[model samples]
Target: MNVAKALLSIMTLTSLTACTALPAGPSRSTGPLVIQEQGSFAAGGKVVSTPGTYDNNNPAAQGQTFHGDHLYAFYQIPQNPKPLPIVMLHGAYQSARSWETTSDGREGFQTLFLRRGFPVYLVDQPRRGRAGNSTVAATIEPTPFDQLFFDQFRIGKWPDYFDNVQFDRKPETLDQFFRSVTPNTGPYDADVISDAMAALFDKTGPGILFSHSQAGGPGWLTAIKSENVKGIVALEPGSGFIFPEGELPREMPSAAGTLTPEAVPLADFERLTRVPIVIYYGDNFPVEPTTERGQDNWRVRLAMARLWVDAINKHGGDAQLVHLPEIGIRGNTHFLMSDLNNVQIANLVSEFLEEKDLD
Candidate 1:
């Protein structure tokens, strides 16, 4: 009886110790655990007025100028993460701030993911937002504000801002969105954008690239350039991939000369087979689009996404296509991330990552 009692005590102690020793990680059961670190960084050189000249000025305008088109990133780390961190890329005419706050003022995807114990790297694309301006981006003219974004995003009818669905519905939400739009010159170099993003990959090991709208081009380009790109989540990746000839976007160069098909081939998306991808679209997408260029872009983008998926699968890559409404999630515009029930959408993304073992 004494020996039996002693053995029981030893077993109980071992069990308790095992429980205490467990690391703080997200489980299929409990959610995100311990957070280890969190911070922000510039993906490229910073403009310093006082790079070398700090005579009387401690920090203000020492007369240093930083180059533009450099990517900037901020990250939050959980003590235990299921997969590598996620690198979020915003679309054209916007900054990394889009992922941080909604037009309505609610928390954005950054908060949602951070709460889930996933490390998130939010980016301000080169020549946009905090990234400042650069020689490369200077040559292009300006992308005027017309119905290009308003109608194309399906936010509402052209020239009408208040009619469509919105999160805050308050007059302020509308103000907030328009305020968030960043300036751009002509067609910004997607290759330079990708290079800046690749530099980010170098700083922070391998991870996922989550891109929205116009950001998809650079997102795909970055995946091609960086081996560290484990997977990609392209949301509303422009026009339905387009409904024209069931064709996909041609590859533009990341640098001066194209080396081989393995590098930056024009139409060969097959090279991305090793990486997993998910192309997601929101409600009101043009399934049967018109021939009109603007109204028809969605059809092409949609077709682009589907074909990309098929092409990837055929080439041994894993890619999936998802429509918000088809899954019973409806009324989302191009700004789906800031939509009313973005939490639900975030859940879907999380589930996809887990399903693919990305997190």
Candidate 2:
């Protein structure tokens, strides 16, 4: 009996070991992750100087001269590139790093799309990130606003997370998310940003423009200014919807504040009709106005976005607003591109590009 029990125990241990062993064959590989070219450039800014002569004795003196108002773009072209490259622009309080990696250290949209054979250009807009020089100066107070942004970003409440939210919700991930917030070296000026982005398009020729949050307004203006913007993918653009000069929507009121729409000339508005545009929003928006400031903020924006889409389609333009929840993809936060299900979201975008013939 003892000999039989020993044999059975040995057999069970062997089975467990086999189960934990690593596979022997070669792992899957869809060709090499090769890059034919990778480089960076400063685009669309002018040189500015103080009104004084050079002071070699004191370089810190008021006679400083430097280039300001330019944007920084980093490009990665694959060995075999797609027809149209993708130009990525971040939103308020962010830099090009926004698209580089997720808060939890997962692969971001930048690399994901790059692997799909598309050239990727990541931009640090004027007066932010690498392009820190600005024509105008602004005071940057070290205000403790992480909690406020935490709520505003729809990640969760200050001290708690929403049920089954797509964010990782780990302490380290939250820390990384907060640390990623960058301060602008200059004030937020839509005209300056649009001008710089227009210059980027001018350099890159025709490419798909991907903008998030605040950059949406400038993205529209850039497309209007430059014919090189062939398509657009906007993620949760919180503001900057442009209407015809005489057809602006009324201001939307919410617990957060009032949401307003910008206006553009009819000719400029018509420029957007030339390209396909898709706007994506994540979950957790209240059906009606709520006392929760964070939730209410996006509620108004989503409403405004629907109107904006209608206006675009009315003008013979191809524009769509996709609420992920309505389509059965639930629990995503405002930063859908960086959420846990970002790959799934990226697949949806890939489908859009293929459908529009922009791939």
Candidate 3:
């Protein structure tokens, strides 16, 4: 057993080294860096507003669009010689303002990046913050069956469901409930969100996409589909249909029950990929401790990142797997970006981008 353990350890270390050795590809230019701060009357003009924090636990007001409900975003255009623009997508249940406000009362990522001359546009994802306000109250409630399932099976509870949980209440079974709530299904991937972003770009020009968790998948899809996206910074992006073979679980829930067709295989990491990608994961992010099933899910996420790194390298794309130092935080859950030490993490990101000349 000891010998076997040693071999496993060696193999894991070898794999990590191989993954990090991948070369970064040439950078693409969005032409000149043009920072446009003023709102224009162009088709897709810049819409600027004060950063607003929503209850994130309430219903939508009458006639308000989901994307407009609790939505809060801040765009900072530096006056310095044109620098690369970055678009930040918030994690689940969070507003764009959270990136600027520290839970421990420190400066936010927005100010930090802005000071460094990187113009940033922070946005709340669909069904979160200002979007889907009608379901905000549901974010705070525990599902009856979810509670029962945890009690009976002693499995860990699901992460906060937020508006998704409320939408699932009418479904007959848990499986159906899951199908009902995932964002990629309904108004989420809809043009409204994309249009809002495209308009922002029309005013601001080309930019890099930075997204976390569930928002990461959409961010990738949008970047791949839209011409305006120059690169992507995916922080623990959820599994897309184009995942590494044997890395992800076969039984995982499809995005909104719409499984990817066999004809449209998972993304190929090897080959000359168009957009550059930078991936990061929390080293201390915890696997589900209470349930084996939960742990399996966590393992899939870690494995996916490894596979993605390998594939991107083979394809001659610029991809990096960043392992953050465990800063005394037990189980690196998704919310670490909002922590006080986020500056440390952000600095690492800035360094990586600089090293690759991505900015």
Candidate 4:
């Protein structure tokens, strides 16, 4: 009986060792993962000779012009143009090119939209992208308020500071730098962009508006002000109403030390409901509570949209909401527009445009 027991124990140990061994598979390179990396293409569908450098001589680049006071933008007019154009707006601290690249070589929003036969225009908003502080030196130095926030939050350093922050020659905290930079004239900036688009439309034609994150607020404002915008696809728009009499929840902490009564009033969004609007929310995206009260900010955002939608529908306007699943991202956060799964987002927008006959 003892001999039989010993044999069984040895068999069990062998099985455990077998399970611990790594599964056999194809060998992987030690370097970074390279997915679908491809060469850049010009607006005319011709492959540019230089990979990274913008070719000013290209007709596609020459066709568009930038306003003297406004920032320059990159555009790709399709070789085979579709009915309407599409203007893409990047989020905070990102360039017009932010939607186009991934670490694994996946095609960006520009490539996807171009392939769909639509002319794509990417803009770098004021105080951001190439138009904003482009130097590495501009990011490191923080302002007094930034330091104060850091001290309050016990944050030692900013994440991705090396890549995103612009340090000045003298000492300044992040808050000071942010305050020093001119606010882009709020909704007026959006009006100016819309005017620029109107000129583009006069030359090219009317188009669809696509905005991500914080830019969504301005894009919505722009659409409200413009007559040419056919439709809008807003991805994760920030807080909408900022007016003193607006319908913000009483629970939300007001910006700075001001009460809700003291805050600046945002324009009435319900009145501007001529075009169809689609609001997209990512289920897996994590949003930080903007206030110290730990309110569910994203929920508030959706609620605000719902309020606007209800108001719009009452007045006979078309508005829709889309919520994406959480499966695509491994550890994704609020910046869902820049994730690898953004291709799915592109596909969704394409489908919406086609269905609405706006493409």
Candidate 5:
């Protein structure tokens, strides 16, 4: 985090407060102006390449260590932007825009939460969006544009709509969805992302982390590590746990190049229980769909959420898995934040946070 000296010294930082972005008129509301700032931090650092210098007579490759991955976020405080803040994390292949703007021209959670008088910090996870890249350019590979997400995420069929598709966007909106997709670089390090998140959380005050899908994994880990994280609202976390698949029980790699594998009890994460935890799933999930992959994905995710809720509750953590269909808000997809009924869900989140005393 001290690297602020390294980066800020190199360029001017961009900090956007609520008043600065307002129209030439009154405050958006009677509340404080929303304060927002965006910059990248080296949560954890690593030398990605050997340092070298380019000179008139000779050119050498500058040794570079990836300072963990970059963290790009826009934070808002009311009075304008304040805390008990909600940190929003996007899922795989998506950036923080997951909470900023929707493809249907709808406002993202950032706007909704602001209206509710809570500050918000939105994250672009490593290798995505404002969170920029870390690996050598040649090592980067883009996530394939495929039906995998559409079907698995329950957005719709590849070229057709699945039964009761809840995505609710016009056909033209597909362009926006596609445009939001970016090629990703890997050996994705969940631990580094978690540390960056923790660093950000420590720098800010304790509050909440509202994470979506893949980001849910690290969100759990970050909350586990940081006392600053008071609560976590995980939206359909993958496999219902922190740490990535293929890495097994899950190993967290630090910027210093240390790999810490999962060795703690699920009870350890009950730190979440000290506060409150909620796992929210969208509609059309429990009922089987046409694609075998989608069907299996749904079943697995549902089971995962269930398992987590059970485990967390057993550990004295107040974690609940909510199915939207069961609550009268149906036809939602994995991307519930952008659904036509998004406001309904955001309201549910706001009310839950208020009830839990997170607000």
Candidate 6:
């Protein structure tokens, strides 16, 4: 095992290259941005309490109420913020910190978008990260699966990186990357997460929802539950494409595992059509199934995403899938938002937002 994997065995952990000539980001003055307001709040959860009398001095097993399953969000509003805020949700094994700083110690999307005049809200979903309280309890085993994720994330096979990969491969950077993988404090419940996300939207009002990896499916569910989601930007959502009940496709087989697409009521699935959505994928994905599990897994997802886009567009929805390599942006991993060319990716997203009039 490499240094990163070795360290991850003690803890637990956690990209791609871009092709083409990287485009320049929008020029901005290299000065600190002015923030009008910044703070954090918890949204969406119920209080659970035991029915019994309790004494203040003897509060061990007494009747005590617990507030659990709420999502925590931190926000920053600029002097002249955009109409809609960007609420970012992290994927599995990650927290809102994923958007704060890149593994290479660069400014992350939280600040990058804020500089673009969009109020930014980073979320820690219920039972994860800052939102650790949950109605259901769970035990998180300290399994040494860092190398497993290393392969699964498509940076490269364990202890190796794809040629021309965009990730920062310094040992220290890998250490930071590994340390970012956090365990869920409770069970992974999509309904709970979606409910919490909807609550967050309810509190923040209409805004753009950004979901990465595991949060992708729940993000869709959140939009269905709340009218506050005006737009969606998903980065490499592994699964959770909702199709009309009878239109569900056959389960796809992948080297990593079976790729299962969920079915929802026609009405619920139609909710996605109301908003403009974009999905992005990074590089190093083989066009055909590869013997490597990591590469093959993504190949299947990319194929399914194409079908998903077709379904949404057919339903009169505005959805687009951008495969970075096809567009000449190469060497991107799953975490494109934090990659070395993240600013370029940000500019791309900015253009999309402007095109859709969401900016």
What digit string (tens of lDDT, one per residue) describes model 3 on residues 106-130? Answer: 5567666665667777876544544
- For all candidates, the clash counts are 24, 0, 18, 16, 31, 13
Ranking by TM-score: 6, 2, 5, 1, 3, 4
| Model 6 CA deviation exceeding 4 Å by range | 1-29
Write candidate 1's Cα lDDT for 1-359 as tens digits.
99999999999999889976775454323443466787788775334233556445465555555455577787888666646889998987788888987988877887778767688899988777777666543554455665666666666656554343544556677678778887764247777788899889988898999999878877877877788999998888851132123333463221112111113443435547778889888766456745444435565566556766776676677889998778887777787788888888888998888888888
Q: Counting only residues 3 or more apart in sequence or on different chains, how many pairs clash (N, Cα, C under 3 Å) in candidate 3?
A: 18
Candidate ordering by lDDT (highest first):
2, 6, 1, 5, 4, 3
CA lDDT of each candidate?
Answer: 0.71, 0.89, 0.51, 0.52, 0.69, 0.89
Q: Deviation in angstroms for 25 in model 3?
A: 31
For candidate 5, what is the total of clashing residue pairs? Answer: 31
RMSD of each: 7.6, 8.5, 17.8, 15.0, 12.4, 13.5
Write down the TM-score of every candidate.
0.74, 0.89, 0.57, 0.57, 0.78, 0.91
Off by over 4 Å in 5: 1-44, 47-57, 62-68, 80-82, 135-144, 240-263, 287-291
Residue lDDT tens for model 4, 109-155: 76677766677777666434444422112333333454433222212
lDDT of 6 by residue, 248-333 (tens): 88878888888888999999989999999999999988979778898888998888888898999998999999999999999998
lDDT of 1 at 323: 81
Over the stretch 189-228, how does candidate 2's per-residue lDDT look in tens digits? 8888889998998888899999999988989999999999
lDDT of 5 at 112: 75
Candidate 2 residues lying further than 4 Å off, grouped into runs, are: 1-32, 55-64
Whole-model lDDT, model 4: 0.52
Between prediction 1 and prediction 3, the one with superior TM-score is 1
lDDT of 4 at 281: 67
